[model samples]
Target: MHEQREFIPLDKEQTPMDTPKRTIWIQALKVAFPHTIPILAGFTFLGIAYGIFMHSLGFHAMYPFIISMVVFAGSMEFITANLLLGAFNPVYAFFLTIMVNARHLFYGISLLDTYKGIGKKKWYMIFGLCDESFAINQSIDVPKNVDKGLVMFFVTILNQIYWVVGATIGGVFGYLITFNTEGLEFVMTALFVVIFIEQWMKEDRHVSSLVGIAASVVCLLLFGKDTFIIPAMIAILGILTLARKPLEKGRVSVQ
Candidate 1:
């Protein structure tokens, strides 16, 4: 006689709701904080400088805070500072902003696939996609156990905090502040390098990465530093378009 076996569910893992909301947020913050350390140092100093500069220009402390919160772009905010001193011209300012932030176009294109299905947080991600934040978020592969959205959100918020706080403090106490902060800018470069190496190590095939490096180098050599980015972006897009089928096939085969 054949024996009967007991039936059991294949997968009875804990769902997200099973965990406490506080625990979930705490975990996300824990994962996200280390990545923002460099930003903390860099943005704090830079924001302070920006705040002091605005104070020197006779603007109120609140000006730096409001601009830091609203504009959020370091270079653009600096440009806006100069623009504030100049004659009023909204039309010129509009085009100038576009020119200053044109590189974001490439960033948006590169992130299209990755940003899908992220829900409402996607808008904030796009809004806060500074060079450092994008580098960290796109390079990171969120672990299966953690919430990707929360981690990214915290990263964005923390970076902004460093900048805003610095700017606000500097603006309020510009007269009292007198200290050298020459090398703090290097933190941003170091952060990018770390992220690049992490991404390089994680990839099974460095085909696309190599292409990016090669194209960037070639364009930089040919076009000079100030105008090579657009060409490099175009080259990357073309190369990726041509390689899409093979890349997709390799991904499928691996899966």
Candidate 2:
């Protein structure tokens, strides 16, 4: 008879039959979760505010819940809430929504290389690419062993979940609440500023950052708050595209 071997128990984190896919996801989530903490705090409060605003507008809690799930466009959802209260105007709504979200076009282009080869996850990545998600994913430097795509996928999904959960809670309980949300909208702007600073600290050069600032200021001065977003995004995109080669070279040299 052959010698008997002793049985050994495997930990939850380990499995003999586990595929690389599962392992990568575990590693990715570990890396991704920390980066999304800021977004979680910001989205939670803002999403609640959005839910409360909708409830105050005579819409049921389901309205915010479903809209947050479907639209996932924070600013546009608020505008859509108002639109629903008025006479139907698909044409106007279409143009207005496009104008409001025009910056996403630039966002998509910027993420093309990052999101490529991500397989089916690319669809959800594109869908869930909100402001906070974009900011975090764009600025993050994933570890060599982790899967960048999975990290981004988790970041996108977690942010969406935070928004959806918050909106749902607010919708379900907003009537029982009575608090001031006057300045809550600024949370997103504050988050962006923080992310910008983080990115600035991580980078060797500030050319791109400075370009973004100058473009925004000039556009805001010329087009005003109501109309500057699209122009600013366009300016940023054009400038960055033209400077892509220099930026790549600088990055390589720094590395």
User: Which lDDT tens digits does candidate 2 get at residues 68-117?
Assistant: 99999998999999899999999999999999999888789778766766
Question: Taking the tens digit of each residue's C-alpha lDDT, what string does model 1 give over 1-255?
Answer: 213433221112333657877787788889999888889999998899999999999999999999999889898998899999999999999998887787788778777766655557778888888887878777766677887777887888898889999999989986786576778788887887787788888878888888999999999999998778778888988999899999887775453
Scored by lDDT, the top model is: 2
TM-score of each: 0.82, 0.83
Model 1 has an lDDT value of: 0.82
